[model samples]
Target: MTDQFLHDLLGRMTTDEKVAQLMQLATPFFKGASNSGEITGPMVNMNVTDETVENTGSVLGAWGAKEIKAIQERHLQENRLGIPLLMMADVIHGYRTIFPVPLAIGSSWDLELAEKSAQIAAKEAAVSGIHVTFAPMVDLVRDPRWGRVMESTGEDPYLNGAFARVQVEGFQGDDLKNNTDTLASCVKHFAAYGAAEGGRDYNTVNMSERDLREYYLPAYKAALEAGSEMVMTAFNTVDGIPATGNKTLMRDLLREEWGFDGVLISDWGAVKELIPHGVAANEKEAAEKAIKAGLDIEMMTTTYASHLKELIEEEKVDASLLDEAVLRVLELKQKLGLFENPYRGADEEREKEVIRCDEHRQTAQDLAAKSAVLLKNDNVLPLKKEQKIALIGPFAEGNDILGPWSFLGSTDDAITVKAGIEQKLNKEVIAAKGSDIETGEDDDLQKAIKLAGEAEVVVLALGEASEMSGEAGSRTNIQLPAPQLKLVEEIVKIGKPTVAVLFNGRPLDLHGVIDKTDAVLEAWFPGTEGGAAIADLLYGEVNPSGKLTMSFPDNVGQVPVYYNHFNTGRPKGAPDAQIRYVSQYLDSPNAPMFPFGYGLSYTTYAYDQFSLSRETLKKGETLTAQVNVSNTGKVAGEEIVQLYIQDKVGEIVRPLKELKGFEKIHLEPGETKTVQFTITEEQLRYHHADLSYTSDPGEFVVFVGPNSAEVEAQSFELE
Candidate 1:
């Protein structure tokens, strides 16, 4: 377990054994292998030998305590030196008790809740015998067309970085060595995987060095600073070369400049993908480039196992690179205490007691409630319990609310909207499966309309199916399916007070539901306790405190619209700009349908008396900006106070506003509170043309408001 012992172990490893350490195969490879080393089942074509299988350093997608225990026992018994297999899985959102998607967690804007949710996820996964989790994806996304946007927090680098820090803290608790409930968090897609072209998955990513550092890379840096044990290479090309084989990105910047000594892993089959990316011609070249580029592990690929030895023998790659990679892998295993106790936290009895207990489910429900954003609400919301209710749509009785990336969560255990409502009121509410996620028959529409006639209120549960968003779930049209919209139109004609509760993964265009529905709630893929949490919001048991982390477009045409955009030279509607020739769309507004930090509550708050401590801020000194906020409505509610900064004039063009910091506070009806934010010279520093991180001496403006669109501004000078 010591460093010396790891080095000694590495020194004894043969070329074949060392290469096997870099390969990560599916759980089935080990389970299906015979005692005679004959590769069987799906991977027979791979021609992998039994020795390689037995000496394999890690196993991917291995779940459940019983299965992992069996795999580890056999691996140690058959191996020459008995190195335990490192078990890993995609415990993205949850293991069994699911929580809302990462996008929704960003909407909550509550660091404590985000951290707690990750901690719960780690606890569940650790009990199931997983030693590492590929999570806290933290790729700052702006375009909604990318299906993986659901995995990220949102568009802003600052917000995503903040969440990344806490998620790492929660996953790798104060003491990873002693804490059985903790997991070794793997912050993924190392470089800018989120900036795929046209929001397409695995597309080429091209951006200037300044643009890349300024907008992306901050969250990954923050996660490393927070002590993540592993980093996964992206599947896309950074600059011109594939990230899996880009030596400048993986070695110069990450391993050398940043000093990230953690295990560098390749995204699924990414190392071999270099061949398809045109960087490498064959498997040997791919393995050489990936290893030389500092990739420690190749997930679901045979390039490392099949050709690493040949590349090392031909003198194309050094043997020291293999030693370094194997040592990193062994260090990780020792850190995980796999050498001392192979089954560190895997207990079949304790698994049942911890997986989806009441405490974990309560946290999931609470987070889902806070993560649900109130996008639009008329006086009709917070429905009266006594009012007759008719809940109808694809999601009425559908239980696919766990969202994508929830690989272990069971739909059978998911509670539906109908089940949630009846459990809350203790009586059956009339419900109808108006349509499937795509379309329905004419009789379905008539039946839903008739059901609306029986109730005083209609709650429409609709949105994209769990498949429409996540991983390969991108879409050109982000509106609700035509069938759901048609069902909405017919129900709206009936004239009952309507509320559209959307269960989706990405920020939707919301054309049909927004205008026709009297009220709208963005309940984005709420997990296992989704139905119950939504029921809580409908009956006023909980107030909505979530905000939009990503902007919702008016239409797909305004795909990348966000609040923190540049003021172009030919700005639209500027005082000095001309009319039609400006940078304005003829058919649509440049602003988003809903800006970042925009959310509504059952109650309201007003901001006034904004002031700054001084007009001039000197170096090595700080300034305090304060604003008096009052609850103007009757009910008590929680509000997120956002602080945005804009450099009036800089060396280069600056954005209209950039969110520097925010605070979420509670207030009683008619209660007033003075919220203050301390601004320092460091907060204004940005990557200049030469990538110098320093603030320019100039005029600056600070704004405080409920959301990004509406605010009260005050100006100051940095001297």
Candidate 2:
């Protein structure tokens, strides 16, 4: 439908019908309307009537071709205007053929793979009748204690913004209405949801406006610029106002300033949550505040459904706001082609044919391999197949490799590590569950010891269970579980060659595992084909090239440690320096266990001959930094050459270094490549003390190397 047609449709809708368009409910409400409906679960007290349920404009958490087709057909038949109900779900990583979690995908530093994974998810989800996916969650997260950190890319505004754009392009493609295999992308948690205080889920977020704009808002802005059709409000409060009702944030910044005219939906029950956040008195007040704040949809709540019509009638809320919100909803439906065909892209045969197909699985396998980070190595990797091997740990035979938010992926289809290893070697391979993931009393430690004694080498598969990481999965202690550590200690006492393969979601403190293992691979929740990918890396079929997106702390007490932190007045000196009164920990080093952008490959590379095109840069000039990287080792490998910039002096203190650009290159033995980065004046701009974004004339330092901590530096002046 065109704009005129959508306007006409809105003109024809009644106040009740228009209000219903702004309300979204789950499948339970629809299933509980008649004699056949049981009215089970949480919807019992929602007081949702049959008319309200039938008039709802969207349905979430309901999929499958047959189920969606029936729901849409029924909704359209009952809806007086015949406006179709939009089907949306949380298709985070994959629909069936799961890929690595978002954090792991960030580690790959492969934008193409990240985009391809979203593309596959879109295709699979589209065929299953899902028109929208609440994905590509572009929140920049520095705190791993926020369980949802697994949902976001790591903590860099530039990196997260870059990935956000690609993910949006992959999901919506060029033309959303014409693309049958694509689903509309919704970039979520609109303003600083990831910066929850205490690193707790849904905790209050109190940050300066400068911090919000400098670090939190870029990725969401980038996604909208990439043409995302929807934006979801955050669950936390910005300053003292809940994001669901913060007019300054939702209206002034998002709508007026950013010009985002797309549908703005509240997170699940967030609009109603304003009452609990102490901003609203009741459902009517919550409904009024949300609509006035420019929220178009109240997801999974009856606040709008219960009180919006009365609020409009009493003139507590303007009727035009209702029409505008309804217009955005109809506009989205029109763009999704729901106006033409209620069951858009819902095909049972296509769903069966495309779900977890070989091509999709191959892409998952490829991404899984690229997402594995090599944290430590001592010539113990690339295990020889002829040597007797022992694969011991809870994860060796377990198939729970798919991380959280993989709602549709079945564990039955997941490939176990034992299965992947057996396909490679014909020799004796002893596999044992050394201990349970969190319990040491499985009585399998003795058997694991015997297997290790018989084998020439041991591959210890360890890490947190899949349940330990995603949403509501925060951990106060970010180290390996005591039982798993005990298993590692006993196995390492045997003194055989050991390789530790970790499957986790968040960055972990790996001091214990690193001390005992000869090689450590952080295979963070690699999806469906994760086991196969791990086996491939171990056997040299694939080289480890993934980098750390989030920094690993030395201990849990060093929470919120990131590489791009601002320098304090008293900075810590080198470990050898016995300096007092410095900002150093009494018992621990000031540095992270593993720095950001840190990873190891099977072979080594050397960086040399760093040069700059100019010693001074003008306001509008671009400077080029060049570095020569050579494969100095005996084997072929890939390297992520990183470029970082630092402002020598600023009105406000700046981070020690900020990642500006990076290039991943592959080289053969003895091959040398020249990596060049073009830095412009725009890259130097930052939010000043008064919140004005500008750059200062001063000296700047440029660093280029493999990771943030180890780099070669040069100086230049900005005029």
Query: For this target, which candidate reaches the highest lDDT against the unseen true structure?
Result: 1
Tens-digit per-residue lDDT, 129-163, candidate 1: 99999988999898998989999999999999999
Return the lDDT, model 2, position 45: 76
lDDT of 2 by residue, 1-719 (tens): 67899888888988888888888888766652232265566667788788887789888788788888888877877888888898899999999999999999999999999999999999999999999999889888888777788888898888999999999999999877888799999999888988888788888999899989988999999999999999999999997899999999999999999999999999998988999899999988999999999999999888988898899789898889999999999999989888888788889998899999999999999999998999999999889888789999999998889999897999899987888888777444569998999997657999899999999999999988889988888878778889899899999999999999998889888978998899999998899998888889999989899999899888777878998899887777745544887888889888889999999999999999999999999987999999999999888988999999999899989999999999999999999999999999999999998888899999999999999999999989999
Q: What is the lDDT of residue 444 in candidate 1?
A: 86
Q: What lDDT would each prediction earn against the true structure? A: 0.91, 0.90
In model 2, where do residues sit more than 4 Å from their true spots?
A: 31-39, 426-428, 574-578
Give the true-structure RMSD of model 2.
1.7
TM-score of 1: 0.98
Q: Clashing residue pairs in candidate 1, if any?
A: none
